[model samples]
Target: MNKPFADKLRKIASYVPGEQPQCAGRIKLNANENPYPPSPRVAAALRDFDAATLAFYPDANAHRLKNALAAQNGLKASQVFVGNGSDDVLALAFQSFFCSDQPILYPDITYSFYPVWCGLFRVPYETVPLGADFRVNPRAFDRRSGGVLLPNPNAPTGIGEPLALLEDILRHNADCVVIIDEAYVDFGAESAVSLLPKYENLLIVQTASKSRSLAGLRVGWAFGSETLIGTLEAVKNSYNSYTLDAVAIEAAAASVEDDAYFRKTCKQVMDTREASAEALRALGFSILPSQANFLFATHPQKNAAELFEALRAQNIFVRYFDLPRIDNYLRITVGTDAQMARLTDALKTILS
Candidate 1:
């Protein structure tokens, strides 16, 4: 450990990302990354791109990407903000909107990054507990909080709360910002974007990483009122002017323009998610009804830690968090049919 670090930095408990294994014949379902390739237009754009622009700095504002995103979401460019990824967008949001004496609110079992961001930004936060069924209780969020943030089709649990309940939470907390991270929205979950016009304080953050199959490119955005978007831009400019590179801007625009391919890939993942859930349930696992591309499941008779290790031994990886309440569960990403079939076969052998 390095000496004389900032006391706050030393106290911060960093977030642990899913493993990225480099092994032969690995079936990776650990991270909720899309199994499909990015839109062919992305490659076409890259191929046709002029390398000469690489000599100059990329656009600081990323106007083209923001405009495309705004057009796709039926909003103006002024109401859109893009970042390196949704993680960056989220960090900016934490810094911009959550600077209050009151504590921010999020689900106890929501995205692990929430707490990490709060700590990094020095924002006080309180975690509202999810219900016994692993669903959010929106009423618990009616308190006077600095802000509210939670992922739709909530991570690790992969269960989505209805828009009505989400609206109820937004209604109660109209004075503060409510960030609905729809990172997996395209999988099957209804986006809170529909409620954006009604609630000015609402911000819906999404990523091209999952549905658009551009994780490596790291593009993400947020849609909200012009006022909210302006705040994020202010924070972003203060943080990093050239957050996204030129290639990423062009590729993201191309991907968003090719709506057909995006829909096809998202539908494929959702279809595979449903089938995989059924397969896990048939294997004596209690799988959550997931609207995301991943499933949260636990077996009644088998130990989750053992299963996670066993799957890893067979070169098949899934996400397992040894946290309280969810220590018994495994969050499995939906891979291709063949990949999932291999996972199923591997599980059958483990169970037998």
Candidate 2:
């Protein structure tokens, strides 16, 4: 007799991430990764790590990282939670808040992982279509259920919703959790974190990946009411007690305190994104205004899939999705000024 897999596991499609290669020297702008190095203090933490701790199991609650994040966000440690990445924090949110009969509602074009997480946890979900301009129409969320999940400065499109509109959603979203994924908040958009105290249901999830440039360290955090954090902590405890490594905790703590480095790097990336967006528009590409560390540009005359492959041939990589509504667009990460120059030159040649 053959043993069967769980029915829940059988039906779901897991998240498919962008290309991460063993081969180096490729201009990788596919994923919204920070091109600048993380804070120098982060390196110091790693270099001076406690070697004796290797033999001991890490602090399962990760009190060190939590304390640091809490202090940085001006919240109590009880209102904070950390995970392997913001994706992990989001996964726990799905399990803790969305374990309901109602369907989780999100923009049809938002982070692809929202639906993937829903499927993974057997949560019911519904997708509301974005507007003709690919912006999340606030009115679409007026009627909702289990919870609300959205990425601000939403990925692939890089279009952001104003803070005023998000506050309105909080007023209306009293039934369940409202999760704001602020992975790209540092670049331009105003973060929804300030509303955390007023809205008990709000959970603002962020990562060290973009602004902190600690993607390699895989640190993510969630800020909300202590009760919501407790619920997520329960889920995290049930999954993996030691959700973060020792080195990661130290690096994250250091990175959060090094605001000077973070601000400088974000400014650099923002300046380049504006310049790059203009360049793409001049090249006949319709560029979406981005608040993130990347842009979503679609050439009216060129096939996006073709562009994906052609850019790969030039050793330049950007993200291209086969999903509905965004298939024609190229989600290009904002790299250094030099990298953007190389991409523009390549586009000119390809368009010519």
Candidate 3:
């Protein structure tokens, strides 16, 4: 019997997201979700929302959310593009800009979804290996390619590259589109948004998931030249005109309006992350210097797989990748002070 799916789909490997267990009393640090609650403004907006609006179709362009994002980023509304999430925006960008014969370029250990999008879009790609220190080498992407996609504070490793180096890659790839996924940029990394004026080819994609604590709302957007944004808008409209619902548009716009609360929560997470990294080091773990909300670490004396299982046994969850180069490392999201205290205590007992 023949499979209903296309032959190309059969040959592609799907991207597996982090585990999402629903068990009670589980300290979930596996997915890099914001440990803090969303801004009070979001609550207020939801309370004020009229349920009667659900009958009509939402704004196809999400103009309210786009305006808020554009104002915040010093861009015009025409220069902004909103989508269901950054993943959707990225997928569309892959299809819109990476159609050339040359393969797209990305870090070997990047967001992982990049390869999946490439596979889905039937776009050829090549992975540039990160340096021994796990930093992206700008010179490596100086050659010809279809386009470039990079996560600015790379995931799983949590190491951020300098903005100057990013500019170098942009300069090198003048003929192609360059995308900098700044999903975790709110944590501490320098954003490439400042280079927008000088480089018309750059697209900066960000999300409300991590910093705004609205992962469930599923709102993500991008900033780019009007031409690039227009292209994305055309592609998105062709696929799904109503990408964001009314509630999501209102809530996400409200999230952007409460700038003070956003900064406060981000600071809390950063503080906890530094403290947690120090605590892990005390337990003989070699922790990476992370600018993001998560810490990547490894213990020389303990197997990562065993430790992952042990943590799960204790009702604590953190991410572990069995892939090459980082098979021995664990990615631990920084939760609340109390949650991190519990995690450290568990590690103490496990190591003892």
Candidate 4:
């Protein structure tokens, strides 16, 4: 066998997702999954779906789901693009818009997949450092580049940048595409979707995975000018015509339409996040004010690495990055109140 893989893939360090442990009794907070079940409507929609539809290829365009998303976001159907997940949406966007000789710009501590996409597509990229407070300084993006992408409530840090600052970046990079990954926007962060009319270069990607509890369905979408959306659709079709399956399109549509359930679930998670932050603070953790379904915190007296192991041994799971600046911190997903209570109790025992 003559090394079947391509030369580019052989040299790439692939993106590593959080561990999905199989322990039945463990509290899973490492992947930022929603604790609540998806809306009752999602279940009903799935039940109502015709099984024979699976016998045929899913609608390559996913027009119905796109219409639902557009209605939810108050945008026209032409301004929305759907993908298997935010990851797929982002990867397609990277392929569609970032091909210039200049390097794409992103935060040094953003979703780890950014660099992986850059490598896979062979697009050059430059990482701008987050400020000492672990927030993206949008002003730093005022430079010539192929494109820009950053999470609103950035992962690992969970701190959301203000919309005003994001606008400044968009203003400076008007000629280039500015991708805003808003996976956690429904939790509390201000969505840039509202600014879509003002900045044609801006593309905002969102997911049903977080707020809608549809991670398992693998449905994500983006909002932007019709031209940007058309480009994404073209790129996605070139790769996979049926990007979203029948089950996912129906589930996501139901989730989007159930506004009351969505708002209630989001409030529950946000409430739990605040309560968990206070509990961690009482344990001597220096917590950041997060607008997402998770918290990023560091302890004054405890070693994050050792604490992570201790929690794991107790069947509690939280994400601890071994990267620079954040090695000392832990990113904990807000789970059900019971799960969070177990985590706090375990931490109390470990710290004592």
Candidate 1, residues 292-343, lDDT tens digits: the string is: 9899999999999999999999999999999999999999999999999999
lDDT score at residue 87, model 2, on the 0-100 scale: 90
| Model 4 CA deviation exceeding 4 Å by range | 1-9
- Predicted candidate 4 versus true structure: per-residue lDDT over 257-289, tens digit per residue: 899999999999999999999999998999998
**Poorly placed runs, candidate 2 (over 4 Å):** 1-9
Cα RMSD, model 4: 1.5
lDDT (Cα) of model 4 = 0.92
What are the TM-scores, per candidate, against the unseen true structure?
0.97, 0.96, 0.97, 0.97
For model 3, the run of ten residues with the poorest summed lDDT: 3-12
Cα lDDT tens digits, model 2, 1-352, are 6657655446668788999865667898988999999999998998999899889888888888888888877899999999999998898888899877988888888888887887778899888788999887777888868898888989878988899989988888898899999999888999988898799999999999998888888989999999999998888888688899888888888998887888999999999999999999999999988999999999888999999999999899999999888899999999999999999999899889
lDDT of 1: 0.92
lDDT of 3: 0.92
Clashes of each: 0, 0, 0, 0
